[model samples]
Target: MTPSRFLRSALAGLLLAAGTAGAVPTASVPEFSDWPAGTAPAEVGRRVAENFAARSFQWQTDPKRRYVIYPEICAWYGALTVAGLSGDTALRDRLYAKYDVLLTPEGAARVSPDAHVDYRIFGVVPLEFQVQGRGDAWRAIGLTYADAQWGNPVIADGVSPEARWWIDDMYMLPILQVQAYRASRQAKYLDRAALTMAAYLDKLQQPNGLFLHAPDSPFYWGRGNGWVAAGMAELLRDLPADHPHHARILAGYRAMMAALLPVQGTDGLWKQLVDKPESWGETSATGMFTFALVTGVKSGWLNAKDYAPAARRAWLALVAHLDDDANLAEVCVGTDKARKTTKSDDLKVQYDFYQARPRRSGDLHGQAPVLWTASALLR
Candidate 1:
């Protein structure tokens, strides 16, 4: 037999021999150090992404109940990127089926009449479907949602949630606007995105270039800042070079990258509390930043000499978090900057509150950003 076939057969035999009652086969975990630099992110991304697909990208579920939720839908954003790059038809088909179920005949999400900005994040997937020639209605649904967001009283001040700005909106709002712009070629979509981002930067950006979680909060939460960085990068990617505010958005992106460079942990990750040295390293933020940095370098927006090492380090550190079966570890659960677990927006969470948040395995927050980073890396 050929060496490859012989090796596979022998390994299977050995695993069987080693099995005991109810014992699962041990996975032969590969070393990250051996992975080549140029293609490491994409290679690792494929493994983790496929594992996610097999499990249907849902963490815990009732077999009978299937509906799109915000978190998993966010993960699909990354998986869709990989699908486009790798041309993996099976993966793309599965995503299309889910999108089909989520939308109506006219392409609106199936939800209560009072759906909010949170629901609008689904605007992106339909644009993906339209590219495949089956999502025309889906594209309309996404555009209609953008109209709703523009008219929402919550953003009367030109940002989400009425009064105060939150870092999380960075990921949710601009992506839809950019995708809408991509689908319809409408300047209004791009105009709305730039206006909102400019408002956010004016409110939250600190002197050193990092952003506050909210104006009332003092802590620079890692993933929150990561959201801002990633959002700015995404906007610049689509915002035309001749667009009125292109220079301003690019400036904000570079400033955030400048602040991020010095704070990265020796291990190549950022802390849960970004400026707090004692806080633990966080995977999701690290992955997001890696994605932005690599993208910036590749796009000619960032200087390769200054940022490449940081990008490479961040990528490698992110890979180290993946387990034998491709599950990403140490992802913080969904949290806001609420202090003392109180009901008010002014609640100030203790430093330990961030440091102590539970870490999860295979969370979409972490998984999605990893794929984004992988897709950004040069093959």
Candidate 2:
């Protein structure tokens, strides 16, 4: 996360996202009506469920280049929540039972006992708490003091400032703290959430209406910001409507959604550079943004009349971006670390100069968001 490392990571992402101009997704999008009438939501859920079940992540064997914070819990939670809502009880049961291990000795350790400063904890709890009870999460915070390590002054990547941190942590942690606070009735969780937000809002926000992905990294990626947007919505849902920051949270989401609309490619996807699509484009970011806009409407945080069309448009764009297998192409895998050292060898090319070689789809950095997006799409 040093300055040198920042440039290399940003360049690596740029190299990977640069692609042959994809065909503009001008085909008239199939309507939701086109989703076979009477097609059970569970049907699609099962498809995604099977795909997620087959994927695995074991940190011990994983390379640093492949890491993202909360692969195991995020995938399981995304699979169940997105799939379960559709009445895919069987898949839901499997997912829930699969993750129920949180209560077991092994699963609890993965999400907790150390979640106070664990980045993964922020990402994991929403999916896990939303599915199972929040009991284990409460245990994690209760077992130890929250904010013991994270509150330390800036060290990695200047993320201690607001502008740089949002794209990375906002998507996961703040809301997790809110929920943990509510369950434990501990002030520390809320205190941590508020303190993080103050730092994030101050440094990351810009008049141009983008969150600094980080000080060293330059791309204002849609998925990363979208993670922040969606996380805020989820956080709002968890807090009492009377909370002082509630209105500010809605304003932030509105700003993000407005920022997204202008940069959307004619094809409905987002460019990797976000505002500068002529330079780069990516589907995963589009999907996450689409989810946020759509969910915002559903939650009454945004008006469907104003935002749903944009959401629908982005969904069609996302669908076109996916191949037959429901994967996002040109995703800067593990960016999912906006700031980390990138070796020169990371710049190897594939697609014959159209784009870098595809990282395996099982990559947690990509699948977690994809699963989260699919869940968003269904809801």
Candidate 3:
């Protein structure tokens, strides 16, 4: 057998022998059906999914030079998954049609050719399409980006060439690689994600179970940590229990969840700067945390009694923030890591930077997590 294939076979044998395969529950235990008005998972998911389908592609800069940005990719992926989970074929078809536009000459010109993490995450939408049985073409296209992530000869700390310790990469990088594994059933893709995650957990996870924006940036930026929480939940959902890195990944996920439980606001939201009482409630991080918590409780990775209520509270609270147009409010604007300006500046400067970020309604960054949380509830 080929080396990769042989390794996969060996892992399968180990899983079966150890009986850890299928040990983790894949479905929610309590089946979260008791949502308040306008808060039902399916109802909210469809609203957000439809919103994404009807919108024009978002861009980082000039509309003329537009390429699919990561935020759009995130919302698109969430919409596709929600369609499949809710069994809404019409919604799925609409999403597919939207993607088909990307294949046209005009649309193809808009696909970003950059090798950066944000650009590379565009691969996830196609990979999700492949998993939904769209076609072989998507699998082929998606793998190109996944493979290119590792194509650079230079490697840092034995992870992907794209690995930067920025907490956002925890979601951006792993979700793409995990989706590639789902589409292709390639163990290498899964291994790459696990290794990358372990490296991040070792470097970024703080003593309090939260993560900093970066090594030098010591503040608990909520959206940044939200990326880590959601990424770990996504990876743990698919990673085999027998994989060498599974235990460590699970430990990290559980630790983060435990830490998040106490800090959730009385209103069921988390703030832009999570640990700061003065920071305003932010929807993107709250939605991401809700998704992670709901997934954990459903998958039996967390005690339903402890996490289920928190998850439900978070979902309801998040939905309450949604407007008539399905736009979530109070989303923190996209932020780069806050760096120290001078030797005299303390960590409060970084904390203030996060608190001062403006909030917007209907941002894809916030919308994507709502869809994801909705899907988790339904799944």
Model 2 lDDT at residue 149: 33
The TM-score that candidate 1 achieves is 0.81
Candidate 1 per-residue lDDT over residues 1-379, each given as its tens digit: 7554454344434433422122111121122124565346557767766765666423135444334556665677777777777777887777677654334643333442344545677667777666555657867977876676676545355554422367778767888788788878888888878877876765567766787765545678888888888888878777776777665566667768878999999999998888877789999999989888877777767666678788878888888888877788989898777452534454343555667789998887898888888767622
Q: Local error of candidate 1 at 18, Å?
A: 61
lDDT of each: 0.71, 0.52, 0.84
* Candidate 2 deviant stretches above 4 angstroms: 1-43, 60-69, 97-166, 179-195, 321-326, 336-362, 377-379
Name model 1 segments beyond 4 Å from true.
1-39, 56-67, 103-115, 152-164, 340-349
Listed per model in order, the count of residue pairs whose N, CA or C atoms clash below 3 Å is 4, 5, 0
Q: Estimate each model's TM-score.
A: 0.81, 0.68, 0.90
Per-residue lDDT over 188-301 for candidate 2, one digit per residue giving the tens place of the 0 to 100 score: 565556556544544565545466555555556555676676666556555544555544455555666767777777777776657765645665566567657655665555
Candidate 3 lDDT over 263-317, as tens digits, reads: 8899999988888877789999999999998887777677777878888888888
Residue 109 local lDDT, model 3: 77
Candidate 2 is scored at a TM of 0.68
TM-score: the better of candidates 1 and 2: 1
